[model samples]
Target: MDKPDQIPPLSIDEISILFFNRQNPVYIDVYDQQTYRYFIYPIINRTVFFGCLIITLLRPLSHLERITIEQGSSTLALELAKQHTLTEVYYQKTHEYFTELLEYRESELILTKGKELGLNMNSIMFVTLFKISSYQDLQVLEAIIHRLVSIIKQQMARTEKIVYGFHNKVTLLISLSSSDSDHISSITKLLDSIIKEWNRKDGPPLNAGIGNSYYGVENIRKSYDEAGKALSYLTEQNRPGMIRYGEIGLNRFFLNQKSEEIERFLNEIFSPLWSHKAKKNELEKTLLVYTDSNRSAIQAAEKLHIHINTLYQRLKKIEEALNLSFNNTEDMLKIELACHLKRTFNA
Candidate 1:
């Protein structure tokens, strides 16, 4: 046997009251459709019970009061619906503008539309891309995206930043005042903080790629392309971290080379190894280890977890297959360049 639940007493003073007047008189009752019960409001000489507590009022609503309340509620709902429609239209237009900007279509029109929307494109200093690792569920992905966007907006304290979500990536366009000299350092710190906070929240790790700062709206597309290029490097290496387009040094030049030219160079340099499928991968790994180890037989062997004799044997086999001498400075340079090209372009 259990004691009955205690019901909280009604307190009229705690609740605010709205007064309304109307001409017509009629009987009216308010019922909660979801709860399948009559709405509760305590009046003088009348007690009303709600779910767990009681709310009190001074007097019962007259028919005139009910008519006034119904009209007021309808008006408020209509106003809210209009506001929602307007918001939806604005967001649709914004998405279209951003899509065109990203696709490099109608730069002039995009800038014009951005200006109309009160977006200062000239203030944009950086484009950053965040690539999410694979996720199975769309709802989970959406949740992560919403959480990230909310956190970024709160931390940055700037509503001017533009964030757009694609398949599994988010692109952010960061804007800074013209007088801000420490833009790069500030942006880097902000991004680092965001990544750390996100990881702390038990979110999936993201690979961030940042593009160089370019002035003017016309160059925005270029910055986006550079950010994409930086992200490509991260994906190719299968590494989870941040990479800046400007920081990649000489590899930038090689990356910009025509695909056909890179393919030709790779074929010419490594065709011999490719001909022998059985040992190609093994030889390629050995060659990379040897070159990366500064051509030190002992260092390369240690890195590869192989004996010095075995490393020597592999090197001799590679020289024989390519009909080239590893000792020759020119030959070593070409091989080194080819290896770099392959790594950077995944050729």
Candidate 2:
């Protein structure tokens, strides 16, 4: 209040204080004798006598209040630190279980350990893999990951969960009651909110893939693998956001295959279509739309913005060139899978 208008703009700390002050209302202790005396007596007597008296009276109380706040803060900090330490240790152990990366014969031992660590072994447990990208600075990436982890912990504060990070990815193991109906929907909503919260802070691009919940220790690795596969589907197609493993369908199997293998599989099924120079791309589009539209010629034509007769002619050409009958269930199945594989590889 005594300073001139030549002050610099607010520093980070000053802005933070301003933010906190705006968020929290200011409180006035009107009943305090010191406040009453200081404001009223200073105006009336215009002397330092009451001011000195108030200070002398308030000194001990101020000291005691300061000590109380300090000790309370210190104790709270220690308790939180201890709790966080224990949580991290449990998370590390869970991470180790995943790190084993294989189902072993000593699954009972691992299950016992998990139960002891507060994991609900008999309940529905699954994993979600999170990946952060588009950050070139290591320090910024680390900070973003840390912020994301904090957000996860906050969001799942009421749940039994294990959160551990390695490199640029985080693995979250969440346990739900077996009777919790609509688990996938609930999980999706939770993850969507978490991602939105992170986005609100202008955090890095985040993507997650959720695995199906399974019982028993042997399926833990499978769930983790499924989560990774789901995430791979997102990355391979250059898409973002969350995908559940069950939703990926057959791509789950193909995702584990090598690129060359996928290419060969695609080529075997699509060679004839690719060999057609003029309409290869068009034919592929037709096949994909045909199957995706549930083999409804009218729907496919409407989507393709062409007449039904034209769609029929294109289908005929496709069948003739591929030396297969769309009427045959096996042939149609192959065509459908080929389309899926083509998309999975973005070919």
Candidate 3:
């Protein structure tokens, strides 16, 4: 296969000399971060018409480019980008360089392509449903999450909020953006498309958040949260690999926190109870609600719509069965985390 370095990277020094050597240029060549990073050779030509041949052959962009031309001067640079499906391009010298090109969006597209190429997610918007059955493997899993997070670096981007709520499995996601009317319908369609594509595939245990049309890298965590809930709903429902955020709806954020691995955590927590699937599931539900209701048994009962006494009885039974007391702040914190485990790791 051809290599990037083999293709040649345009040198800034060489390009500067070439541009300055030209006569009164109608369109002087300018290589922004994207052009410089992608092309070993700078994009330069005698007129707007010259360098487009190269750009059309290589589509390396995450956004559409815009080019403004003076009337009767030349054909537009943006026209070339659009015809070739280039991420973006600009003609006017006054136009700012493609700063957003190197934006997190580029990283995300690269990550997505990596997944398509069968590489593990460096985490980010794609929530990993890893099953580290033993305690030792959990270390590797933790390392994976940490590394994945650092690779994506969502914090530095201009995006919507990323909120995490874990029952045990970490539920990171980006918030939805309904600000643009054109985007709302597109987002829904995109989510639907993901559901279709997921149902089509049949391989490695898949769990993932279907991203939204929000033009923010930060809201990736919200998308991750929705996927996690859909995974949680999987435990209740028989189907697997079917994740649609609309199914989880408003309470989605509660299931979005970051936490420990869920499947193993649940298995360890309910070892005794797992023998009886119904009772184990009952405990899981109660804990889920208990935490979801913010540690208030009364509130949990109200949400579950069971009598407060019934909730108290279940809590008491859960405490006795698990050998942990929610009354103890530390124990309660652990339980809250465990409760999240039932949701995140696709248990």
Which candidate leads in TM-score? 2
Q: Write the per-residue lDDT of candidate 1 for residues 1-347, one digit (tens) a residue.
A: 02112222323212212101122223323233321112232221111111111222235657886666656545654564465446446545655666676675556777777766546777756788888876766644654555465567678775457765555777788766663557667777788778766655445777888888777666677888899888877776676678888877767766556678888988877777764447357788888889888899999999999999999999998999888898899988889988877766676
lDDT of each: 0.65, 0.66, 0.44
Model 3 misplaced stretches (Cα beyond 4 Å)? 1-261, 272-281, 302-306
Clash statistics: count for each candidate: 0, 0, 28
lDDT of 3: 0.44
Report the candidate with higher lDDT, 1 versus 3: 1
Q: Which rank order by TM-score, best down to worst?
A: 2, 1, 3
Residues forming the 10-long window of minimal summed lDDT in candidate 1 = 44-53
The digit string of per-residue lDDT tens for model 3 on 55-130 reads 2224443333322212112343344435422211211110121122223355666555434533333322333221
Candidate 2: segments with Cα more than 4 A from true spot: 1-94, 97-118, 133-137, 196-202, 216-218, 267-281
Select the stronger candidate by TM-score from 2 and 3: 2
Error of 2 at 279 (Å): 6.5
Error of 1 at 155 (Å): 1.8
